[model samples]
Target: MFAEHLSAFLTHPVTATVLLVIGIVGITLELLFFSSGLLAAAGVVGFALYFLGFYLAGFVGFGDLAVFGIGIVLLILELVVPSFGILSVLGAICLFGGVLMAAADPKQAGIMLGIALLVAIIAVAVAVKYFRHRGVWNRFILKEQLTTDKGFTASPDRAFLVGMQGTSITPLRPAGTAEIQGERVDVVTDGGFIPAGRTIVVVMVEGTRVVVREIFEQNS
Candidate 1:
């Protein structure tokens, strides 16, 4: 009968370990590379087979499958929702718990799960480092470099505005706007207030900061 074959598969630790490893690694690959959901679908199928085998053989109950399903839901939510690893940790716990519950032997299941997790970690590290074409990773990372030739500057060179005469449009209570060289420039005074409409001269230009001093008119 189908149950006989299913029971045999679950009873053997080697085949069972292979199934768990394949399931975990498939999901891991899908998460890391996003292979158009192909890997994810395969991984889901692998887990479905695992649960189906155990359930059909009467080794695991519906509640065990429910826990596993909940774990899968939590892990999927982790991809969309930012929980700072809380969801992932909880999901992993449920996932491992469900697997152990379904297994013929809890101790063997734990050992196999540990092996699967270790393999998955090593695989991810190798893929990230050696693999050049990261499917969805490219979309998240900005590989383009902004250079001067691309008309990008950290700050505009305002040195040309030095020695230019202008009038303060706002009270430069040490920092205000002034019209320099026919352009409105944000200039700061040398620790002195210059009221609006006062004549000011640009004394220094340091990066984006334009230093200005007010000019006093001479009267007879």
Candidate 2:
């Protein structure tokens, strides 16, 4: 029976290609790609493809088990634990081995890979739209910001920072630390280099945008 199945698999071109693609993508992406919305979707899709191909090739038991095992491990690693890369790799290895053992034909792998990728895209899109407007997102994002500072500088006539003097404390690789009004603040230079220990004069503070110029008050 095994020899007969091998002969049939060898004669099938499309089946072999699909299996190869699904197997390659399922294992490779699971291990190599970093965590992000797109990658997460891709990973699931790849696994689905691998499992489907496995079933079509007379490997039903192996294919279903592979899917279940990978799903559980991924859920744990993606949410429960802070760790990511290592567990993903382990799951991927299991996936690859499972597909190889169960699938009689290597070609159907490509077709399954496509199904997995598409599902991932749809899942991520739905998640983003649904979660974006929830108060949870707002609370999570703004918890660090102070309540009073949220809209204090709304009045344009009250721009009190126009003539402020500051000292550079960070290399400002164009965007670094500067001391203004006895407080350290993040500053940026537009095509201008401001080295550490330099004196800068605030020429304009137009609508939260601070324009500064280097002063040689000492060098002059």
lDDT (tens digit, per residue) of candidate 1 on 1-220? 8678876885566666667776777777776676776876776777777777777777888889889889888878866784766887787788778999998778988898888788777876787788647844676688777887987767878998888899999999899898887889899998899999999998999889999999999998
- Candidate 1, backbone clash total: 0
The TM-scores, one per candidate, come to 0.84, 0.32
lDDT of each: 0.80, 0.55
Alpha carbon deviation, residue 138, candidate 2 (Å):
23
> Tens digits of per-residue lDDT for model 2 on 147-206?
457754434342575678899888767778788899776666655888999988777666
Clashes of each: 0, 16
Candidate 1 residue runs with Cα over 4 Å from true position = 132-142, 148-154
The 10-residue segment of model 1 with minimum total lDDT is 131-140
